[model samples]
Target: MSRYESPRVNAGAAKVVLIVLIVLVVAGLVAASSVKIVDAGTRGVLLHWSAVDLTQPPLEEGLHFVTPFADDVINIEVRTLKYERSTTSASRDLQTVRTTVTVNYHPEKEMIHYLYKNLGLDYENRVIQPAIEETVKQVTANYNAEELITKRPLVKADIQDEITDRLNEFNLATEVISITDFEFSLLFSQAIESKVEAEQKAFKAENDLLRIQVEAQQQEAQAFGIANANIAEAEGEAKAIRIINQALAENPNYLEWFKTRAWDGKLPLVVGEGGTPFIQIPISP
Candidate 1:
C-alpha cells in the first residue's frame, strides 16, 4: 500500500462504484414495477391500452406480475364499504328537505373487470353518486313534508329499492342503506308549528261552544219540571173543591157536621148586627 493516492486510480474506483449504484437502482425500480400486492377484500382489473387479451383472467387478492409500463392493474373493492351523501331536494308539497344518506355497497368481483374497462376509476362519482342522488330526489318528491317525517321508513325503503335496482344494472350490489338525518328549512318548520297551534285553538273553541249549549238545555229542562209540578198542585186543589161541593149537595146537614168537625175547643165572643150576644154553646144530649 502506497501512501501516495493516485488521482487516476481514485477516478477509476469512483466510476466502478457509480456504475454499481446505477445498476442497483435500475434493478430496484424494475422489481417494484414488475410485481403488485392486491389487498384482501379487493380485486384487480388489468388493462393493456387498446388491447384485450381474452386469455388473461381477472386478478384476485395476492401477488401479481406484469410488464412495468405496458400494463396497469387497477384494484376495485369487493367488500362492503360505506358511502354517505348529503343533498337537498323538494318534497311533494314543494318544501325543501335536506337528507343525509349512507349506503353500504361493493362491486361484483367477476363483474368489476368489466366496470373498470367501461367506467374507469371514476365509477363512484360518475355512476354510484349520481344514481343515489337521482333516486333520493325521485322518492322524496312522492311524500309531503309532514308525511316525510311520519313515514320516514317508507321513504327510505323506496329510495333504497330504486337505487338498488339501478346499481344492479351497473353490476354493483347493495347491502344496506340508512338515512342519517333529515332537516327542513326553518321557515317551513315554523309554518307547521303555527298551523298546529291554530288547529288546537279552534278545537278548544268548538268544545267550549258545545259545553254552553248543554248547560242551556239543562236549565230549560229544570224550568219545565217546575212548571209541571205547580200545574199538578193547582189541579189537585180544584178537584178537592169539586168533591166537597158534591158532598154538600148530597146532604144539606153535612155542612153543619163539617163545621162542627172543623171547630177548635176555644170560642171567640162576637157581636151580631142586632148588638145581641152572638155566642152559641153546643150541649151534648
Candidate 2:
C-alpha cells in the first residue's frame, strides 16, 4: 500500500535533509573558528571583534579555544629574527660613510598584543629600520671617519646601545647588533690606505735603523777586543826582550853560554885570510 511515498512527504523529507546539512555546515564553521593553533616560536594575540584584548596575556604555542566567530587570533613571532639595512650617513669630519648593519630581535611575548596594536606585523620596517638608520647616523656623526674605522668596537657598542634603548620603548627586544660592513668615499679610502702604508714603512725604517746601530756597536766591540789583544802581545814581546837584555848586562858570560847553547857542532865554512877561524870567545871581565 505504501510502496511509493507521496510527493508532499518526499518534499518534506528533502527539506529536513537540506536543513540538517546547513546546520552541520554552520556548526563546522563555528567549530573551526573556535579553535586556534599558535605555532611554535610564535604567540597569538587575541582580538575581540577587531579590538585588541589587552587584559589577557598572549596565547602560548599549541591549541587554544576562543569565542567562535567573534574572536580572532593574530600570530606574532616571538622567535629571533634578523634585520639588515644599509645606511648612508656623515661622519664628524664631514665624510660620507656607508654602513651595513644587522640586528637580531624579537617581540616580548607578554607585550605582543601591544606590539601588534601599535606597530603591527611590519614593525621591522616601521620601527626597527628607522631606529637603526637614525642611531647609526647619530652615532656615526659623533666620530671622525678615521675614528669610526679605528674605534669600530666602541662605535658598534654605541650604536647597539642606542638601538636597544630606542626599541625597548616599543616592547621590541634586541638580541644582538652587528656592524657587518663599512665603506667610505673612494678618495677617503685611498687616503686611509696611504696613511697605513706610510705608517708601516716608517716602522720598518725604525727597525732597520735599530738593527744597523746594533751591528755598528758589535763591530766596534770586536775592534776594541782585537786592539787589546795586539797591545798585550806587543807588551809581552817587549818584556821578553827587556829580560834578555838584563840577563846579558848582569853577566857577559851568559852571552857565551847562550851562544854555545845555540851553536851546532859544524865548523864555519869560511876561514880568515890569516888561516884562523872566524869564531871568537868572549872574555869575562
Candidate 3:
C-alpha cells in the first residue's frame, strides 16, 4: 500500500509542473501582446498588419498598448516648427538683392502620412524654398527700387499671399511667414536715397510756389477793393459840386439876397447929412 501511494504522489507532482509551464507560456504571450510608449507633445498612429486602424484616433501621451507583434506605430510631433531661408537674386533693373525669410509650420495630423509620402523631411528644400524664390523674384520684377524701399509692407504681403496660396494647393498648412531682413548694393541704395530726397525737395518747392501765388492773389484783391472805394468817393463829391453850381447858375437873385442878409448882420452906427435917416424895422416883414 505505501509503494502504490508513492507513485500517485509523483503523478500529482508532474501535473503541477505541466500547469506551471502552461501559465508561463500564457504570461509570455500577454507581455508580447501589450507594450508601447508615447512621448510628450506627440501622438502615435497605429497600424495592424500594415492596415490603419481608425477606431482609435492617435494615442495620447504616456504609455499605450496594442497587439505588439502585429501592429506598427508611427510617432508624430504636435509642436510648431520654424524654417528660415536666406536667398539672393536679381531685380528687374538687374540689381542684386539679398532677402531672408522665416516661416512657422506644422504637419496636419490627419495628413501626416500623405506628407511623408509625397514630400519627405526635405520638403522645404523641394517646395518651400523654390516657391519663395520664384514668388519673390516675380514680385521684385514688378516693382522698382523706390517701391521696394517705400512700399515694403505691400510687397511682403503680396509675396506671403502668393506663397500661401500655392502651399495650400499642395495641402500644407502655414502658421506664419515673415520677411526677416534684406540687403542691397551700396550704389543702388545710395541712388534710391538720392532720388527720394529729390522728390521730397520738389514737392516742398511746389508748395512754396503755390503759397506765394495765393498771397499775391489776396494782395491784388485788396488793392482792387481800395481803388474801387476811392473812385466811388470821388464821384460822390463831384456830383455834390455839380448840383451846387447848377443851383447858382439858375438863380441870379441869390447873390442880392445874400448881400442884403449880410448887410443887416453888419453894424456901423455912422451917418451922412444928405443920406436918409437910418431906422430900425421892428417886427415888420
Compare the candidates by TM-score and give the number of the best one.
2
How well is each residue in 179-271 modelled by candidate 1, as lDDT tens digits? 999899999989888989999999999999999999999999999999999999999999999989999999986776776776675564666
- Model 2 TM: 0.86
lDDT, candidate 3, equals 0.77
Q: How many backbone clashes does candidate 3 have?
A: 0
Task: Evaluate residue 223 in candidate 3 and report its C-alpha lDDT on the 0 to 100 scale.
Answer: 99
* lDDT of candidate 2 over 1-285, digit per residue (tens): 365568778899999999999999999999999999999999999999999999989999999999999999999888899999999999999999999999999899899999999988899889988999999999999999999999999999999999999999999999999999999999999999999999999999999999999999999999999999999999999999999899999998787788667767666788777976555445569
Model 3 TM-score on a 0 to 1 scale:
0.65
Candidate 3 weakest ten by summed lDDT: 275-284
Off by over 4 Å in 3: 1-43, 47-64, 69-72, 78-81, 120-126, 150-154, 250-285
- In the range 1-285, model 3's lDDT, one tens digit per residue, is 998999999999999999999999988887766777777776677768866666656777687778867886667675777878887877667788888878787666665555544665577788888888888888887777666767899988988898888777655677898888878899988887898899999999999999999999999999999999999999999998897678779987655555466566544476446663343323436
Off by over 4 Å in 1: 1-31, 49-55, 67-69, 194-285
Error of 3 at 177 (Å): 3.2
Ranking by lDDT: 2, 1, 3
Greater lDDT among 1 and 2 belongs to 2
Candidate 3 lDDT at 165 equals 83
Clashing residue pairs in candidate 3 (N, C-alpha, C atoms within 3 angstroms) = none
Give candidate 2 regions above 4 Å deviation. Answer: 1-5, 250-285
